[model samples]
Target chain A: MFDLQGYGPSLLAGASMTIAVGLSAMVMACILGLVGAWAKLSASYTARATAAVYTTVIRGTPELILLLLLYYGVPTLVQDLASLAGYEIILNFNPFLAGAVTLGLIYGAFATEVFRGAFEAIPRGQTEAAQALGMSRFRVAVHITLPQAMRIALPGLGNVWMILIKATALVSIIQLDEVMRKAKIAAGATHQPFTFYLLASFIFLGITLISSLVQRQLEKKAHRGVGQA
Target chain B: MNFTTMLEYLPQMLDGAWLSLQITGLSLFLGFLLAIPVSLMRLSHLAALRLPAQLYMFYFRGTPLLVQLFLIYYGSGQFRHELEQIGLWAFFRDAWFCAVFALTLNACAYTAEIFRGAILAVPKSDIQAGKAFGMSGLLLFRRIIFPKALRIALPSYGNEVIFLLQASSLVSIITLMDLTGVASRLVAKTFAVYEIYILTAAIYIAITYMLVVIFKLFERILNKHLRTDS
Candidate 1:
């Protein structure tokens, strides 16, 4: 029966920021994943090697290390580059931006695997037939490969989104005013840790449930005609 | 950039590495032990046992482990009087104990699911054979089902072990001087954030690489029939 009256507004505001951060990171992760998968699947040996190493290195390391390095080092990295270019300017890294980019970068590794599997799932014959029909490579990819890959990758991407949402909790360590951070602040101030945290947990649970529902609907839509077949 | 500063702090980083390994080792061991019973409960026909296991797994897997750590570490302070009444306040007071507690709970949830999946993967025909050979209940489980399940579970469980290693990094947030904690302290002292992180990441890569090698060899030996020359 612990009332959230006093701190409810801030918690909601924090949840909003959490969603924004999660979405922004999800977008970046999708972009990185697509590019990584493309490189890994491409004809160039160097491109494939670079993509393989990036995914391997990122997947093996913990996300916290990456977050801390980016948070504390990005500013220095910028300052150093600026000085080298003859401008000695001071720089500050935005916590939200840092959090999103880091999460995107980390999960990009997993997503590459997902997309790679999706790409592999598409039979080569489909592309061959498309090419036999005099379709351009762009047309073949867009019309035949991309849609089916999206259908197959959607479930995996949904899983990545789940992990991404949970990862937003880590950004609180960098002092981003996301839901976890706000809950921590309120818990410390009120000495009602369970109340705030439990509520925050429920909020996270609600988001997860909704996202799962959305994922289900998307899956149904993606498989509309194929499932009947 | 400052190699000397990093080299000077290498000892602290190593100390942190020891603590990290100890925590991950201890927690995953306890968690693995807990996982067996919890997963069995999840597989139970009785709603009473099954429901609790389901809810526990759902909550733990659904939420982030970091918040779980925060709740156990900081949340317990709010109930000191109750904990003191139960004579458990002393345990909750230590950050190390809280970190281990939270990590074990989170790991148990994941490992339990892995166990459950492996249990389901056990061929029913094999169990029927066990029963036909005059085995039943606990005897059947100990002789046949458990062994097969463990074998089936090994690869995924190896991934879980590596994940537990990664998750152990969060203990640094609870004020425990595990690897990440010590590295952060060094960063504060020397302002050599990038170098220290790169060095620490290298150690993690080394550990994870070693684990992958170990697991691959173990799996090969465990499932001799499944091995193929690549």
Candidate 2:
């Protein structure tokens, strides 16, 4: 039973940072997901193959490894290239940026699957109907395909967001003072590992519960007009 | 760039991989075994049994696995004196046991959910038919509920198993020299993070591919009876 006296503000700040990272990474993932899904569903073999490889490589590699590679490996590679070109490297890799990008890339793979499924779920007849009405393919996609695909994609996308939220704790390993890292520091200061860690767990559980409620609301709103099948 | 460097490190990586396999395999086997009972408890009428199982799943699944691993490994170390007094220190003293324990608990939480979902998805008609045939209790479950639920659960459980394999890499933090741990060590020594990490990623992808194949085969076998009956 560790008292929350000295550690409350620090943990709260960490929670805010975790949420910021999760949200930013999620936005990046969404952008990547849509593009990757579109590429995957493209008629061109090369586009599909490239998308498949991206998804496979991202999903197959562990997030920790990706974080390490991007944080440590990428910076070194960039510096080497800069040296080769006889220029100083200006952009250094920060841990937060590294973590966010890695998380975004990892979840983007999952998001692609969700988006692809959603895109495929749209009725083919609607596209045909739009085309018959003299709409261009681009117009059909804009007016018909994208909206329906988004609605269908909402639940799965929400699930990925939840996963990404939890996965942000791994960024603590890179010395980012997120919730888990702050908890570790507090535990060390107080010499109460169980109490601090349990408190951190409660914070995570709270995040999960609150986000789940939000996701449920979003799903409901997304499905407002769509009749239950 | 050369085969010789790879061959030289082969034995070390293989040893690391063996430990990983052992941890993943044993934990998965034990976790699945534990899941059956926990899932049953979840579906049980008794609140005493169901509440605990539900809470276990919620807490375990809600938190990140890394945090859970650190909490168990480092947090348990905080209780070393008490554990030593109780003669339980031997188990907690070994990093292998600690890793296995954390992984087993994590997998149990996930597998229980999968099993519970599959059990719920078992059609009412099947249970009714079993009842009509005079099957009851253990006999009914063994003959009807268990097998069908397993069939439904297999695909999701296979995915969970793959997740467990990947999750095992996190145990390297607790001083278990698994593949990722070895890779980290190699990177530290050789300063070639990219090559070592790429090698580790390749190994993981290869293992994941094999697991996918095995799972597909298992799913095929599970569906064999359903196919014939249909």
Native-to-model Cα distance after best TM-score fit, residue B100 in candidate 2, in Å: 0.8
Predicted complex 1: CAPRI docking category: medium
TM-score (all chains, Cα) for each model: 0.97, 0.95
Q: What's the C-alpha lDDT at position A93 in model 1? A: 83
The 10-residue segment with the lowest total lDDT in model 2 chain A: A89-98
Candidate 1 lDDT at A191 equals 82
- Can you tell me which runs of candidate 1 are displaced by over 4 Å? A84-86, B228-230
True contacts kept of each: 0.54, 0.48
Candidate 1 has a DockQ of 0.72
Off by over 4 Å in 2: A84-91, B1-7, B226-230
lDDT of each: 0.91, 0.87
The DockQ figures for the candidates are 0.72, 0.63
lDDT (10s digit) by residue, model 1, range A1-229: 5777599999999999999999999999999999899999999999999999998888778899999888887787777778888997887789999999999999988899899999999999999999999999999989999899999999999999998999899999899999999999899888899889888888788889899999999999999989662
lDDT of 1 by residue, B1-230 (tens): 56776787888888998999899989999999999999999999999999999999999988988889888988888889999999999999999999999999998999999999999999999999999999999999989999999999999999988888988999999999988999988888877778889888888878888899999999988998776865
Clashing residue pairs found in predicted model 2:
none
